[model samples]
Target: MPQSETLRAQAAPPRLRWWTELPLILLVYACYSAGRLLARDDVTTAVDHGLAILRIEKSLHLNAEHPLNRLFTQEAWLGVPADFWYASLHYLITPALLVWLFRSRAVRYRAARTWLMTSTFLGLIGFTLLPTCPPRLLDAGHGFVDTMAQYSAYGWWGGEASAPRGMGNLTNQYAAMPSLHVGWALWCGVMLWRFGGTRLAKTAGVVYPLVTTIVVMGTANHYFLDAAAGAAVMGVGLLLTPLMLRAADRVRGSFALRSGRSPEASPVRSPQVSKGPRASIVSGGCQTSAGERFPRQRESALPTGAGPDASPADTGDGAPAAAR
Candidate 1:
C-alpha cells in the first residue's frame, strides 16, 4: 500500500509534533517563578546563591578599596545616561531575542529560552540568598555609589523599590553574584554562533562574548568572579540539555512498551524453502546436504578385483539390482 493510505490507517495520532518537553518546561518555570517571589519573604527565601559570593568576595579583600574593584566601583565617568543603556538593554534585548526566535526553529527557540531562563533563575536565587548590593547601592564614601539612582537623567527605574513585581520579575535584584546579564548575553552569543544567519552572525559570535564580559565588569553589574560563574552555569546547562529531551522521549517510549507496542517489529520474514537435489546413500557414506557426496572408492563397469568369495558376475548382478 502507498504511504498515504498507510498513514490513514492509524486510529489516532499525536496532536503536537515533538511537544513532549513542553510540560517539563512549564514545571521548571513555575518553580523558578515561585523562587523569585520567595525573595520578598525573608524567612523562606533561598538567598545563599548571592550571599555565597559576598562571603568569598570579603574573604579575598576585593571590596571597594581593591584596584580592580575601584575601577567598576567608581561613578560612571561616561555620565549617568549609561544606566539608560544598561536598564534598557535588560528590558529590551531578551524579549526581542525571544520574539525573533518565535519566528525561527522550535529547537533553537526552546534552547534559547532554556539558557536565558536558567541563567536568570540561578541569578535570582543568588540574589535572594546573598543579596550583595551593586556598587551603586553602596552608602560608604569609599564603596561604589548607585550612580543610576543618584543620576536621574535616564536611570529613572534604578533602585526604585516601588516597582510592582510582575511575571516579568522572574529573577532577583540584589543577586549580583553570578550576573545573568553577562551569562544570558553570552548565551545569546552562543546561540547565534551555533545557529545564526551569516558572516556577520559569525563575527558577532566571536565578538559578543568578549564584549559582554567587558561590559558587565566595567559597568559593575558583575565582578570578574561573577562573570566566571555565569559562564560556568551556561556550560553546565548546555551539557545537561540532552538529558532533558532524552528523558521526555523515554517517557513516551515507556508508555508504548507497557502496552506491548513498539515501532512495528520489522515484519518477520518466512524461511525460504530450498528446491535442490535430494540426498542419496553412497558406498560407506551418506549425503544429507546440498552438494553431492561420494564414497572413497572409484566407480567402474566391473569390479577392479573380485573378492575371493564372489565372482565378477556376482558383483555385476549386485550392481544391477542396486541400480533397480
Candidate 2:
C-alpha cells in the first residue's frame, strides 16, 4: 500500500467494544463533573457575570428566560414536566443515543462520540473561564424562578441543582456559562437525523434539541446566551474532530511501537530452503542411480573406494541406512 493509504487505514475508526467504551465514557463524565466542581467561583463574582449577561441579552432583546420561566412557574402542568425533562432527559437521552449509535450505526460511532466528548470538554473550559450563575440562581428580584426547586415535590432533585435530593452539594450551580444540556441535545439530534434512517427518528432529531432549548430556558437552568455559546462550542468541536481522531491515532501508534510491534506488520514468515543434503530411498527395492537429479536435494560424495555399482545399506522396508 502507498504511504497515504497506510496512514488512512491506521487512522480508521476502531471496532467498538463495550468493555473499553464503558470505562472511557465513565472517565470522561467523571472529569466533566470534577471540572464543574473545580470551576466554582465565588457567588458574588458569579452573580456579577450573570447580571452582565442579563444586561447584554436585554440590550439585544434576547431575554427569553424570564418569560419562559414565569410561564413554567405559573402552570404546574408545564413546570413539573419541564423540570423532569431538564433533570432526567439530559442524562438519559444522550447515553441512550450513544448506545444506539454504537450498536446499530457503528460505522459512525467514533466520530460522533469524539464530537460529543470534544464539545463537552470545551464547555468545561468555558465554565472554568466564565463561571456565570444560572438565571434561577440569581436574586429573587430578577423574576426568574427555579422550576426544579418549585417542583421539587414532583421529582427526585433538590433546590440547589438538578442533582438528587441531598447530592446537590456535589454539583456546581455557578458553572452555567455554556450549557452542556443544550450541546448534548444538539449532538443527539444530529446523530439521530444523520444515521437514524427512520421517519420517527428524523422527527425526534428535529424536536429533541428544540424542546431541550425551551426546557433549559423555562427551567431557568441556562440563559439564552449560554445556550448559544453551547451551540458555538459544538460547532468548534465538530470542526476539530478530524484533528482529534488523527491525534488519537498517533498516540495509539506510538503505544504500539513501544510494545515492539507495528500495526501493519505481518505475522507469517517466509519459507526457507535448507542447504544440507537430503536422503531418498526407492520403493519396491529399486536402486537409485549414481547421478540422478532430485528436486531440492544436494548431491553427496560417495564413500571412499566405493564402486559405481555399490549400493547403500538399507534397513527393513526399503529404507536407507544412516551415514556413519
Candidate 3:
C-alpha cells in the first residue's frame, strides 16, 4: 500500500456507527420486560407483600401517598395531567435523551447507555424477587385510590396505573418496588447536568427528576421508598460500570490476541530487497526495510547541504554512519 494511505489509517481508530448499539439495547429491554412478567409470583402472594410494604411505610410515617392520591383525584385537571406525564414521559423522555446522547455526545454515550441498561436489569431483579404492588392497586380501605382509573375519562389509561386502555393485561403490574420511572428520570437528569452546555439545560435536568418523583408519588404508582430504591439501583450500576467495562475489554483483548491479531496493530509491509541496503524518505517520515519509522523533524534540522544521498547517521562531524 502507498505510504500516505497507511499513515492516514494509523492516525485515528475507526468509530462504530451510532446505530450499531441500538439492537443490543432493544434486546436487553425486551428481555427485561419479559423477565419481569415471568418473575410474577401468585397474585395472593404479591398482595401480601404489598400489604407488608404499606404497613412498614405506616410505621415510619412514610405513607404519604394517601394524601397525594386524594389531592390528585379531587382535582380532575391535575390528575389528568399527572397521568399523562406518568405514562408518556417514562417511555418518551428516556429514549429521547438516549438518542440525543448517541447523536451529540458520542464519547460519553457508551458509559451512559451501559449504566442505564445495567440499572434497568437490576430493577428487573428487584421485580423478580419482591413482586411488590403499587399503592393504587392496594385494597380500597387503604385510601390509595387508583388515580389513573379515576381519571381514565380524562386519559386513555384503565384501572392500571398509567397503563393503556386495554393493554393493562400485558404489563407487569407487580413490578412496582424499584420505580424505573424515577430511576430513568434521575439518569436523564444526571446526564443533562453533567453534559449540558447551558445553565437553563442544567436547571431543567434538576427539575425533571424532582417532578418525576412527585408524579410517581401523586399518581400512587410508587411509594417514596420505591423511588429511593430506584436511585440506589442506579448508583450500583454506576459503580459497577468501570469494572464491567474493564472485564469486557480484557475478554476482547484475549480473543484478539488468541486469534493472532491486534486490533490496533499497524499494517504489515512485504519486505522488498533493495540493491546496496537503501532507505527511503517519505513525506513527513522515513521508511526502512528494517521496519523503523522516524518522524520528520524540521527541514532546518538537517545539515545545510544534506540531500537524498545523505547518510542515515551522518552528523556534522562526518564519521562513518552506523547501519540501521
Largest lDDT belongs to which candidate?
Answer: 2
lDDT per residue as tens, model 2, 116-227: 9999999999888888999998889989888899899999998889999999889999989898999999999999899889999999999999999999999999999999
The CA-based lDDT of model 3 is what?
0.77
- 50-81: candidate 3 lDDT, tens digit per residue: 78877788898886677788889898778889
Q: How many residue pairs clash in model 2?
A: 0
RMSD of each: 13.3, 10.1, 7.9
The prediction achieving the highest TM-score against the true structure is: 2
The ten-residue window of minimal lDDT in model 3 covers 291-300
* Total residue pair clashes for candidate 1: 11
Whole-model lDDT values for every prediction: 0.53, 0.83, 0.77
Query: Which window of 10 residues has the lowest lDDT sum in candidate 2?
Result: 270-279
Rank by lDDT (best first) = 2, 3, 1
Which stretches in model 3 have alpha-carbon errors above 4 Å?
A: 1-14, 255-261, 264-324
- Local error of candidate 1 at residue 288 (angstroms): 22
Please give the distance, in angstroms, between residue 98's alpha carbon in candidate 3 and its true position after superposition. 0.9
